[model samples]
Target: AYFKEKGKEVIYDAEHFFDGYKSNHAYAMRTLQAAAQGGADCLVLCDTNGGTFPFDIFKVVQEVKKNFGIKIGIHTHNDCGMAAANAIMAVEAGAGQVQGTYTGFGERCGNANLSTIIPNLQIKQHYICIPENQLVNLTKTARKISEIANVTLNERDPYVGNCAFAHKGGMHIDGVCKASSSFEHINPERVGNKRRFLMSEVSGRKTILDKIQEINPSVTKDS
Candidate 1:
């Protein structure tokens, strides 16, 4: 009512109740229905306990969609190591948007990793939201948010991680040098990430040549 008085839409986070109790499909359904009736723009189902499995999430999401004809969103935590999977299941069940922290950093195991979710949605699922050019800005946005929060970035994060585009194996580096798609699922440039060829026990001549060429294309092996 307050929001409506102010001419704004209301959205229930639905975190507190889920965190305090175990999985209650009935409660979730009732809450969603009530929110929809209350004029909510979207109903966000939060796996605050972080104990729900992918299949369970799918079931609940599907039921909610059948019950309410409103838009659905998902908020998952990483406590059970299935946050990403549950989020994907919610989407498959017709959830339109996913909400989470940047590097899965939060109060507990952290929220769903947007870095992983974004790539999974765009590359694998082929869903379109922002412009292709703005896709690269996703990484920049993550870093900026992390900086503001004074949190260190994770190196192993799927698409936006520092090492996400790094190649170390001899065969992998060779293929990437010739054609990035040879070893990479998606071009790093597409996400504003730079491909790195790390020199070590696995480094090969092709890797060296590629790095050198990148620095100075005019210089050849003889030069």
Candidate 2:
């Protein structure tokens, strides 16, 4: 009523939705209905404490879709290290939208990492979030956001991280040397990143051979 009077849009964030659903599933459904009745354009189910696992997220979201028959969105945090996975699972289970931040930057453990989610959606799952031409800027955008926030980027942050594509173990490097896809989930360059062969004590003969060939094409493992 207030929003209608003010002519403003309503986007109800169902805060602590996961916990609420766990406590009383019926009550949570009612709350969503109430929000929809009050003119919410989007109903965002939130994992406020970030404890919801991916499986539960998927199941609950599936139920929500069946019952409500309305558009659903997902908002997750990272306390349990399942935020990104939870968001992805929700979308897989029928969520129309996902709420996240660049680099997963937020309070406490942070929000779902759009950096990870974007590539997993567009490249792997074949969902079109942005144009193909602009996908390359994802890594650069993540770094730029970190710089603006005056925070050092996490090198292991899924696709955009410096070490996300780095391989170090002997067997892993061997697999990558033979077939990049064997050791890598996606081609790093697809997201403006690069595959890196990290030299370590775990280096195998294949690793050494690949490195030599990079420096001099005429070199062979036999030599």
Candidate 3:
């Protein structure tokens, strides 16, 4: 009402209102509809405490979209390890935008990792969320944001983490040697990430072969 009184657009950050606090989908739907009818430029659904599964999120988001024709957005937390999945499901259910902190950094577990969401949407689902050439800049963008916030980056964060594209297991490395798709669902290069080969006790000849091929493709596997 304040924004409307001022003749300005209202954007509500309704994250986590759905966690375990309100288990009623019907109520949620009604609330979102009312917000839209009241003149919200966009309706944002949040996985407030995280922990929401993809299937559940899909069901709720689909209903919201069906009931309200306004723009939908998703803000997910990383608790219970389903932030990325929930965000994706929201899109599938008709959400137009995704919001999250880079590298999933936030209060508790973390917010959705935009790095993972961007590539998954663009490469896997063929969503035009980001420009094709600019995709590679994702990692740099995440790191830059982390630097600005003065937060330490997680090495295991998806897509942009130091270890996101690293490989260690012999069998996994061998499969990647034949084809990166064998081990990685999406090409690391697509997200400005380079493939890594880690040698350890579990490393084998196949691992070595794959690493060699990755380094010098001219060398045949038989050699």
Best by lDDT: 2
Question: Which 10-residue span in candidate 1 carries the lowest summed lDDT?
Answer: 16-25
TM-score, candidate number 1: 0.85
Which candidate, 1 or 3, would have the higher TM-score against the true structure?
1
Q: Per-residue lDDT of 62-179 in model 1, one digit per residue for the tens?
A: 8777877778889999999988888999999999878887778776888898777877887788887567678888778778878998887787777787888999988998888788
What is the per-residue lDDT of model 2 for residues 57-124, given as tens digits with 9 covering 90 to 100?
A: 99999998887766889999999999999999999999989999999999899999999998889888
Residues 1-223, model 3: lDDT tens digits: 6678789977766755566335775666667767877889888988888878899888877877787778888888888888988999999999998988768877788888888888889888999987899999887887888899898778787888888888888888878888888888778777887888898989979766656888898877667
Worst 10 residues of 2 by lDDT: 1-10
C-alpha TM-score for every candidate: 0.85, 0.88, 0.82
lDDT of 1 at 108: 80
* Residue 68 lDDT in candidate 2: 74
| Maximum-TM-score candidate | 2
Report lDDT per candidate. Answer: 0.80, 0.90, 0.81
Residue pairs in collision within model 1: none
Which 10-residue window of candidate 3 scores lowest in summed lDDT? Answer: 13-22
Candidate ordering by TM-score (highest first):
2, 1, 3
Give the distance in Å from residue 172's predicted Cα in candidate 3 to where it truly belongs: 3.4
